[model samples]
Target: MSMNTLKRTAQIFLLACCCLTMLVVARSGHKPAPTVDDAAKVTVSNVKFEPRTLTVKAGTTVTWENKEGSHTVTSDTGAFESETLSAGQSFSHKFDKAGRYPYYCTFHGSKGGHDMAGVIVVTK
Candidate 1:
């Protein structure tokens, strides 16, 4: 190849390698931590859990913000429980174990797996 062609080819090859390296680094690097608004979240509205079911990775902390009525986040297996929360109140629980955690609102819900109840599924 001509000298100019060889130089252009080398430049293009270096550019391609840099692009590929960036892609690999992006794919393998640590992801950004979940922000407050982006974390596993639930809202208590209309006397029910906004998301009746939630799935999250192990060690994630889920927050429940009570927007309307009085409520409580009581665990079925007694893993973690929150005190009664009034309107505009919030609660948070961290899941360290990988399993299903069923919870309910003591003041306005049941533990029979429905009627204001919620479940959190944690995965490894």
Candidate 2:
């Protein structure tokens, strides 16, 4: 074949491969998690809250997912509390007001969040 013809064929093959890859990726329905301005996440593992402290805007919903053992998310001032959660369990709370919300695990922390504790600060 002529050199120009060979080059054209190679270009066509590459274009076809690119189109096929795009088609496969699109068909898989893989998409990134949508970003929410008023949502946050905290991971609970190793007997402690991962963030230890979190700051978010008022009206934001915060979710805590337990990854390791059984625990509780109790508020220091009796504002909110959760039942004992085992591995893979989760809890969520919406901070509607702007203030500090201190929490702890009833099984490992005290009312004042002495041990397994965390704090959530909400702002306007």
Runs off by more than 4 Å, candidate 1: 1-38
Kindly report which residue stretches of model 2 are placed more than 4 angstroms away from their true locations once superposed. Answer: 1-36
Best by TM-score: 2
Estimated TM-score for each candidate: 0.69, 0.70
Clash counts for the predictions, in order: 0, 0
lDDT of each: 0.89, 0.92
Kindly report which residue pairs in candidate 2 clash with one another.
none
Best by lDDT: 2
Model 2, 11-69: lDDT tens per residue?
99999999999999898878889885788888999888989999999999999999988
TM-score, cand. 2 vs. native: 0.70
For model 1, where is the 10-residue window of minimal lDDT? Answer: 32-41
Which residue pairs come into collision in candidate 1? none
Q: Over the stretch 19-63, how does candidate 1's per-residue lDDT look in tens digits? A: 999999999998999763336899998988879999998888999
